[model samples]
Target: MRGAPTAAALTDRLTAQLRRRPVRAFWTALGLYAAVWWLAAVLTQLNLPLDAVEMLTWGREWQLAYWKHPPLPAWVLDLLYRLGGGSHAVLYLASPLFVALTFWAAWRLAGRILPAPLAALAVLPLVGIVYYGFTSPEFNHNVVQYPFFALLPLLLHRALAGTPASRGVAGRGPAGWSAVGRERDWLLLGLVGGLAVYAKYSTAPLLLAVALLLLCHPAGWRALAKRGPWLALGVFLLVAAPHAVALWTIDFLPLGTPAMRAAQAAGWVERLWYPAWFVAGQLVNCLGALLVLAALALPGRSEAGLGNPRSALGFDRFFVLWMLGLPLAIVLAYSLLAGQELETMWGAPYFALLGLAGLLLLPRAPSRRGLFAALGLAVLLVLAGLAGYLGKNLFEPLTSGRGMRAQFPGPALARALEAEWAQLSGGAPLPTLVGSFWLAGNAAAYGEQRPPVFIEGRPERSPWVDPAALAETGALLLWREDEAGRPPGWLAAWQGSLCPQGELVLAWQSWIELPPVRVAWATYGGRHCDRPPLAAR
Candidate 1:
C-alpha cells in the first residue's frame, strides 16, 4: 500500500513537469509578428511616393463621407498627421503598430484554447501572406479595422469564459462547470456586438449570429424567456442609436437609402464586385492561409458526438460560421431584399476573426507528415505571393503606383509644391486645388499657406467645396488638366486662357492670380511651370 502511494505521487509530479514546459510557440508567434510589422513599415516608408502621401493629406482636410468609404480612417490619420506635423515617418509607424497589436491579440486569443506551438503555427499563414504584409498600412479602413477585429475573439473569450467579472456575472452550473449565465452573457455580448456595429455598420449581422448561438445553447431558451436577453437587446439599441442618428442627421445613409438606390441602379454591381475581388485577393496573403487551415480543422457534424453536441461544436465552428457565413448571408440577403451589391470592406471584421480562429485550430501534436506539409504549403504560397507582388509592381504600372503614392509619395509632392509656391507667390497666401482630392489635401497641408481654397463646381454636392465661399475668399485656382476638363463658367470668366502651360501640363487651367502678390499653380508629376507676373504677361 505504501509503495502504491509513492508510485501515484511520482506520476502526478511528472504530469506537472510536462505541463510547465516552456512555450516556444508563443515566442515564435511574437517573433513572426514583429518581423512582418518591421517589413511593412520599412517598405511603406521606402517605396511610397508623393501621390500616396497626397491622398492621406487630402483625406485629412476634406474629412467627410468619401464617395466609397466612411470618414473614420481619414479622421484617424488626420489626427496623427497633426500630432506628427505631417511627417510620413510618424504616420508610417501607425500601420506596423496596429499589425503587431493585431497579431498579439490573435496569439492571446488562440492561447486560450490551443498549445503555444500550434498557436504560433496557426498565425504563420497570416504573417507570411503577401496581402496582409503589403496592404495593411496603406492608410485605409482595413488597417485600423484589423486590430479591432482581432480583439473580437478575445472579448468573446472573456464573455463566454468569464475573465473580466466587472463586465458580467460568472455562474456555476451542474457538474462543477463554470460559465457566464445566459442572462449576463447576453448583455455583455450585446455591448460587444454594438461596438462592432459602431466600428463598421456592415458588421451588424454578427449580432444576430451571436443571438442565435446563445439561443441554441442548453440553458438558452430558459434564459431568453426571462428578462436578461431583452435587457441586452435594449443595451444594444442604446449603443447603436448614435450611429443611426448621425447618419440621419448628416443625411448620410448607407446603400439601402434612396440616394444609394439610385447610385446602385447605375452599375452598383460593378462596385460590389470590386470589394468581393479585394476580399478574394487577400487570400494570397497571410490572412488567407489561416482561413484555409481553419476550414480544414473544422469538426464535421458527425464528429460532434451525442454527449452535449452543442458544446462539442467548439468556438472555432461558431466563429467561422458567424464571421464568414454571416457576411456572405448578409450580402446575399441584402442583394435579394434591397437589390444592393455587397461592399468588400463589409467582410473585413469577419476575415480578421477567421484569422484568429484558424490559428487556434493548429494541431497540438502534429504528425511529421503534417508538419512537412504545412511548411511546404507555407513556402509555396509565400513564393507565389511574392512573385505576384513583384510582377505587379514591376510590369503593371497602374498596380505599382496605386497604394504606394497614396500612403507615402504625397509628402514628397507636397514639399516640391511648397517650394514652387514660394518662388511664384513670394510666400503670399493663395487658393489652390490639385487634380485629385488626395493631392489637393497634401498641398494644402504641406504648402506654405493657410486654408488653401478648393473651387466648387457644384456647391450643393459637397459641403467642403463651396462656390460662394471660394468667390468670397478671392482664391486663386490651381487644377490638374485631367481634373479641370472644361472649367466652370464662373472660373472661366475669372481667368481667360489660364490653363496649365509648359512641360508639366497639369490641367487646362493651372494657376490664377487673384490680384497683387497672390499666385497659384498646379503641377503634373511634380513639374510646374512658372508664369510671368499677370501685368507683365
Candidate 2:
C-alpha cells in the first residue's frame, strides 16, 4: 500500500490543483454557496420575497411590458413558472444560478485580460461583495441583470481587442481566434448589450458608457472604424427592436405608474441628498470587498505582490474608467440633473469587475497566502450575512411576534383560500383576483388555479386584465385586512353583483410562531360563499 502523503505534500498538491484548475475551485465554491444559501433561504423564508412574488403576478400575464420595467425579467419568470409547473419555489434557485453566472463571467473576463493564477487571485475578493451574497437569494430584474452586466463587458472587451488590425497587437483578442471569431464576439456584444436593457431600462447607463468608450478610447475607436461596430449596432437594433414594438403596443404604459413619480426628486434638495444617500448605500455594501482588498494588501506579508499588482495597461486603463467609472458617473449626473432618486440596488452590477480593478490598485499579483486571506474574509462575511439574515427573518417572528414578508404563511394561506374558492366557485376554476401584488399574488401563485392578479385593479398596471375580458371571465376581489377590515373605496363602489364574503387567517408556515395572516376576501362572480370555512368569526 502507498504511504500517506506528508502535510507539506498535501499542501503542495492542493496548491498545484488550484493553479491548474482554478475554475474547478471557483465552481465548487459557488456550488457550496448556492446550496447553503438555498437551504437557509428555504428554511427562513416561507414565502417568496416581495419582488419575486410580484414577478409571479406579472409572469402569468405573458406581457411584453409590466408597469414598472421591461419584459425580459418577466419572460424569464414566466419560463421558470412553466418549467416548475407553476411552483413558485423554483425561483429560489434562479438567483443563485444567475449569481454564479455573473461570477463565471467575471472569471472569464479576468482570464481574457490577465494571465491564469493571477486571474484566479482577483476573483476571490468578490466573495466579500454584498450584492453577490446576502441579497442574491431574491431574484428580481436586478438579479437578472447580474450576468448581463458581467458578460457584456467581457464580450465588448473581446470585440474591441479583436477588430481588424488588432492582430498581434497589445490587448488583442485571445490567441487562436480568427477574424471571424472577433466578428462573432461583436455580434454577441450587441446581442447581450441589447438584452441588458431589455432586462432593465436602467442598464442604459452602461450602454451609454459603451458608446463613449467607442467614441473616445483608442481600442474602441479602432473597433468603431471597422465593420465590427456597425455589425454590432445592426444586431443590437435587431435584438432590441421587439421592445420598441412592446412599448408601442402597450402605449408606453410604464409612464403611467405612480412609482415613477415616487422615484423622482421630491424637492430641490433631493438632487444632492438622493445621490449622496445612494452613494452611501453603495459604499456600505462594498465594505466587505474593501476588507478583502485590505487583507490582500497587508504590508510586510510574504504575499507575492500583496499590495502591488502590475499597473493596468492601455485598454485595461480605459476599461476601468469607461466600464466602471463612466456608467456610475452617468447615473449620478442624471440623478442630479433630473432629480430622480435612484435605488441603491441599481449599483449591484457595477462591481462584478471589481477584482479586475483590484489588480490595477495592487502593483503585483498576491501570493497564494494573500489570496487565501481574501477568500477567508469572504467566507466570514458570507457567514455574517447568513447570521444576520436568519436573525432578522427568524428572531423577530419568534421573539417579538412580528413577521416579515419572507416569513409569510403562503402555502397555508393558498391552501385555505383554494379550498374556500372551490366551495364558493363550485369548481368554476376561480378565474382571477384584484388586490395588492403581495396578498393576491401569493393566493394565485400557490393556488391550483394560478389566476393572474390585476395589480391594484388597474389595467395600466396589469394590462392583461382588461375590464372587458374580465367582464366575460369574472374575477375574485380581495385585499388585506385593514384595522377596520374594510374594502377600498374603489371596490366598495360595488358596480357588479357580489356573493357572500369572509376572512382567512392563515397559520404560519413551518415552525414560525407568529400570528396568522388575515386577508379580507369575497366572491364577486363565483358560486357558494354563504357557508364560509375560513372566516369562523
Candidate 3:
C-alpha cells in the first residue's frame, strides 16, 4: 500500500498492533473468576461452625451414594481439602471456576453459531447475571456439571462441522449411525457422557436428548451409522454402570424388602409435601428468570430473530432444548415416580444452558447506542436482583432453621476448633462424628479426621449418614443450642461426656451402642428417640 510497504514491515506492524490489543483479556477474565471464587471460599469458610467441620473431616469414601444424591461432589470436595490444606476458601473456588469454564466454553460454542461480537456481548449478560457475582457452596453438581454440559454442545458442533470422512461425524447411511465409526468420536462422547453421569446422575436425561438429536438430523444419522454413536453408548455405559449398579444393588435393591416398603408407605405424606416444597423453592430461587428468558427467547419469535430456519434447525437449537428441558424432564419424572423433591442445586445446569441460549439470541451488528442502552438495562436489572437477593437471604436470615449461623469463621475457628479438640482428646483419637446445621457443614470445611454430622432432624436421609443404619462408631456430636432439637437417643446409649464449647455442643466421649433405629421411621416420623434429651443423657 502507498508504494508497497515491505511485506516484512507490514507483517511486523500488524503483529505489533494485535499484540497491543489487550491480550490479557483472557487472563483478566480468568483472574476475576478465580478472585471471586476465592473470596466466596473465604467467606464460606468463616461462616462454618465446628459441627459442620466435623462432617467434612470424617465422612467416608464410598459414603457418596444416598437417598438424595450421588457422591461425586463430596468426592471432589474431599480432593479440594487435600489440595488446599483443608481450606474452605479452596473448596469454594470450585463452583466459580466451573462457572468460568462454562462461560468460556459457551463463548466458543456461540462463536460457532453466532457472529463474534454478538456472541461476546451475549455471554456478558449471563456472566453478570447468572454466574460471576452469584455465590452458593451448596451448588456442588451445578459447579462441576455445567462445564461438562457446555462441552457436550461444543463436541456436537465439531462433529457436525467436520467433513463426512472425519472421525466423529454420523455415517451417510442409517438414521442413527456414525459416519466416522466408533474408534474416535463415539468413544470420546461416551467417555464424556459417562463422566457427566458420574458427576451427577441427573445428567442421564441429556443422553436421551443426544440420541433424539442424532435421530432427528441427517448429519447426526451419518455420524451414528459409522459406529461412533454405538461406541459412545458403550463408553457411557461403562463409565456410568458401576455407580448405577451400586445405587440399585446397595441402595434401592435393598429397599425392596417388606420392612422398607411399609416404611416408605408410612412416610408418603412427608414424601409428597416435601417434594412440592422443594419444587416451589426452586421456582423462587430462579426468581422467574427461567420464565422471563423463555418469553424473550421463545422460538419463532421475529423480534428475537430466533425464528430464522437456519438458526432453528441448527445444532444450537437442539442443544438449547436439550440443556434446559432434559433436567426438567428428569426431575419431574423422578419426582412423580420416586417422590423426590427438586432443589435449587438440581437446576443449576439449566441456568448455564439458558445462558448459552441467551447468547445465541443476541442480535448481531447492533448500533453503538443500542448496544450501550441494552447493556445498561441488563446491568441495572442484574444489580437490582442481586441486591434484593442478598438483602433478603445473604445478609439477613431467610429461613427459620439453622439459617446462616453455621458459617465457619475461617482461620480463627479452624485454629480454635483444632486446639480445643486436641486439648479435650488429650492426644487420644478424636471422635469421628460432629453435628451441625447443613449450612454450617458447608462452611466449617471439615478435615479428614473429624467429619460433621448434620443434625437438622433428618439424619436418616442426611447426606452424611447411612440411610440404612445409625452411625455405630464413636462420634463427637456438635450442635447449636438454637438448632438442638431431638437428639439421636441411640447415640446417647454410647453415652460419652458432653463438652460445651463456644457455639459447639460436643457429645459422647466413647463409642455408643447403636440402638435398632428404623431408617424409614426416622426419615418419616422424625428423629424421636434416636437422640437423648440434652439433660437426661
TM-scores, one per candidate:
0.65, 0.89, 0.65
**lDDT for each residue of candidate 2 in 15-79, tens digit (9 for 90 to 100):** 56567776776677778888887787777877888888888888877776677787676677778
Lowest lDDT block of 10, candidate 1: 508-517
Instruction: List model 1 lDDT by residue over 1-537, tens digit each.
Output: 345545335434322332453245445435665555455454434434343343454454554443334555556656676798855566666665666767677766655545444444445556554535545555565566666555655554444553122112334222332444445555765676665554445554655655665567533454556566677778788876775665665566443332353334246665565445545644534454664464434443321111121221254445444654665566556554554444444454455545445543443343333334455555566556555544444434343433333232333545555555556657655454523344455456555453443423333223465545543433434443333454334343445324343222121111221111112443222223344432334
Backbone collision tally, model 3: 44
Over the stretch 1-537, how does candidate 3's per-residue lDDT look in tens digits? 368776445434433332343224334645764565455445433454332243343333446354445566666767776787766566666666677777777767665555443444445445444433454433454566777767776666655554353223334333554334336655777788887875665566666667777887666777766666777788889988887786774555323432343223236675676457656665665553443444334333132322222342344565666655665666666665666545555566655555557545544333333333444444455556456534433444334322343332333433445555566546544433444344234324543344444444245435455533434333444433222555454435333333323343232111222212111111111122343433442
Q: In lDDT terms, how accurate is model 1?
A: 0.48
**In candidate 2, how many Å is residue 410 off?**
1.5
How does residue 347 of candidate 1 score in lDDT? 50
Q: Model 2, residue 314: displacement in angstroms?
A: 2.7
